[model samples]
Target: MRKFLLPLLFILLFIAESLFVQFLPGDFFGGNRILAPRFLFSALLLLTIFVGRKKGIIYAAIFGLIFDIVYIEIIGIYLFLFPFVAYVISKIMHVLQANIIVAYFVSILGIALLEIGVYEMDYLIHVTNLDFLDFLNLRLYPTLILNAAFLLIFIYPLKRYFEKYAEALRDE
Candidate 1:
C-alpha cells in the first residue's frame, strides 16, 4: 500500500504540473519562459533516487509515459530518456550523501543539460538545420532556469513528505 501510495501521489502531482503547463499563459511571468512540467519531473527523479533505484526507475518511467502522451513531441523520447536518467542517478546515489537539497539541485542541473542536449541532437539528426546558439538562447536557457527554480523551491517539502511516507511504509 505504501509503495503504491507514493507513486500514485507523485503521478497525481506530475499530472497537475503538466496540466498547468499546458493551460497556463507563457507570458504570465513577464514573458520569461518556464517548463513547469519538467521541474516536477526533476523533483520526482531526485526523490526516486533517494527512495531506491528500482522504485525511482518505476516512477520515472510512469511519469515519462504520461508526459509523452500529453506533450506534442516524439512519442517515446521522454519515456526512454527519463528512466535512463533515473537509472544513472541511482547508480551514483551511494557516492553522494543523503542530502535532499543537494540532490535536487544536481538533478535539476543535469536534467537541464540533458534536455538541451537531447533537443539539439534531435534537431540536428531529424528536425532542422538550425543554428545551435539560437536554440540555446531562445529555448533552452529559459526552460532550464524555470525548472531549476521550481526544484529549488519545492524539493525540501516533497522530500520530507516522501521520507515520512516511506518510513511509515516500512513500519507497516
Candidate 2:
C-alpha cells in the first residue's frame, strides 16, 4: 500500500498541473509570452533524486507517453524526450554532488533541455514561426523561472517523502 503512494502522488500532481494551467489568468503573460508550470517534471526530478535514476526513467517513460497521448497530436515527441532527459540527468548525477541546490539546478536543466528540444524540433519541422531570441524571451526564461520557483517551494518535503519511500521499499 505504501509503495502505491508515490505513483498516486505523481498522478495527482499531473492532474493538478493540468487544472492549474486552466486557472491561470489568460493575460498573465500580457503578450505573446507564455508562462506554464511543469510540475510533473519537478515531481520527476524529485523522484530521480530520492528514488534513483532507474525508477525515474521508468516513470518518465510511462508519464511521457501518457503526456503525448493526451496532449499532443504527434505520438512520439514527449514519449521520446522525457525518458531521454531522465537518462541524461541520471548520467549527469554521477559527477555532481547530491544536494538540494544541485538537484534544483538539475531539475531546471532538465526542463530547459526538454524545452529546447521541443523548440528545435518545431523549428526544424516549421511548426513555429518564433525565432530563437523570441523563444528565449517569450517561453524559455519564464518557464525556467516558474519551474525553479516550484522546485524551491516543494523540494524539501518531496525529498523527505521520497527518501522515506525508498527506505521502506528497501526494507521490504
Candidate 3:
C-alpha cells in the first residue's frame, strides 16, 4: 500500500484533470481562452522535489506514456517530454530549497516547458493551427492561471504527503 500510494494519487489527479475539464462551462471566458489542467504535471514536479529523482523520473515516464495514450494520442510526445521535464526539474531542484513556495515556482517552470513543448510539436505537425502569439494569449495564459490556482489550493497537502513519505523512505 505504501509503495503504491503515490502512483495512485497521480492516477487520481490524472483522472480529475479530465473531469475538471468536462465540468467547465463550454463558453468559459467567452470561449476565447483554453484552460488546460496540468494537475498531474504539477504534482509530478512536487514529487521530484520531496521524493527522489529516480522515482520521480520513473513515475513521470509511466504516467506520461499513459497520458499520451489516453489523452494526447500523440504517441511519443509526452512519453518523451514527461521524463525530460522531470529530469530538468530534478536538476533545477538540486540547488533549491525544498519548500512549497519553491515547488510552486518550479512547477510553473515545468508547466511552461511542457506547454511550449507540446504546442511546438503540435504546430510543427500541423495538428494545431493556432499562431504562436494567439497560442500564448489564448491557451498558455489561461492554463497557467488555472494550474497555478490549483497549486495554490492543493500544494500544501501535496507537500505534506510527499515530505512525510520521503522521510519514511529515508528512514528505511
Candidate 4:
C-alpha cells in the first residue's frame, strides 16, 4: 500500500492539474505569454527524484503518456521524454541534494530544454510543424516559470511527505 499510494497521489495531482489547464479560468492568464505546462513536467521530475529512480521513471512515463493522450499530441513523445528526463535527474540526485533550490531550478531548466528539443526534432523530421521559438516564448517558458515558482512554495512539504512515507514503509 505504501509503495503504491504516493504514485497514486501523484497521478491524482497530475489529473487535477490537467483539469485546471483545460477548464480553469485564467489558465493562460493574460494571453499565452505568461505561463506554460513545463512546470507540471518539472514537478513530476522533482517528485520522481524523491521516489527513487525506477519509480520515478515509471511515474514520468505514466504522466507523459497521460499528458499526450489528453493534449492530442503525438502518442509517445512525452512518454519517452519525461521518463528519460527523470532518469537523468535521478542520476544526479546525489549532487542535487547539496542545494535543492539549485537542483529544482536546474531540473526545470533541463525539462524546458528537453521539451524544446523533442518538439524541434519532431518539427524537423516533419512530424510536427510547430514554430519552435514562438512555442517556447509564449507557452513553454511561462508554464515552466509557474511550475518552478510552485516548487519554491511546495518543495519542503513534498520532501517531508515523501520522507515520512518512506520511513513508515521501512518500519513495516
Clashes of 3: 0
What CA root-mean-square deviation does each model show from the true structure?
2.7, 1.1, 1.1, 2.9
lDDT of 1: 0.70
How much does candidate 3 score in TM-score? 0.96
Q: List residue ranges in candidate 3 displaced over 4 A.
A: none
Best by TM-score: 3
For model 2, the stretches where C-alpha displacement exceeds 4 angstroms are none
What tens digits encode model 4's per-residue C-alpha lDDT throughout 1-172?
6678776767767776767666755734665474544545665666666656776687688877987897745788777888888877777776767246766766776667676767676877798666867877876777677777777887777767766775775698
Cα lDDT tens digits for candidate 2, 1-172: 8878888998988898899789987777666668767899788867887789889989998999998898888888888888899889888888998788898899899999999998898898888989999999999999999889888999998888888988987998
The Cα local distance difference test for each model comes to 0.70, 0.87, 0.91, 0.70
lDDT by residue (16-115, candidate 3, tens digit) is 9999999999787667788899999899988888887998899999998999899875799999998999999999988998878888989998998999
Model 1 error, position 167 (Å): 2.1
Q: What's the lDDT for candidate 4? A: 0.70
Order of the predicted models by TM-score, top scorer first: 3, 2, 1, 4
| Top candidate (lDDT) | 3
Candidate 1 C-alpha lDDT tens digits along 73-170: 67777787778777877766677776876687668656865676567657866765656776667567777777777777877777887678667757
- Segments of candidate 1 deviating more than 4 angstroms: 1-4, 29-36, 128-130
Pitting candidate 2 against candidate 3, the one with the higher TM-score is 3
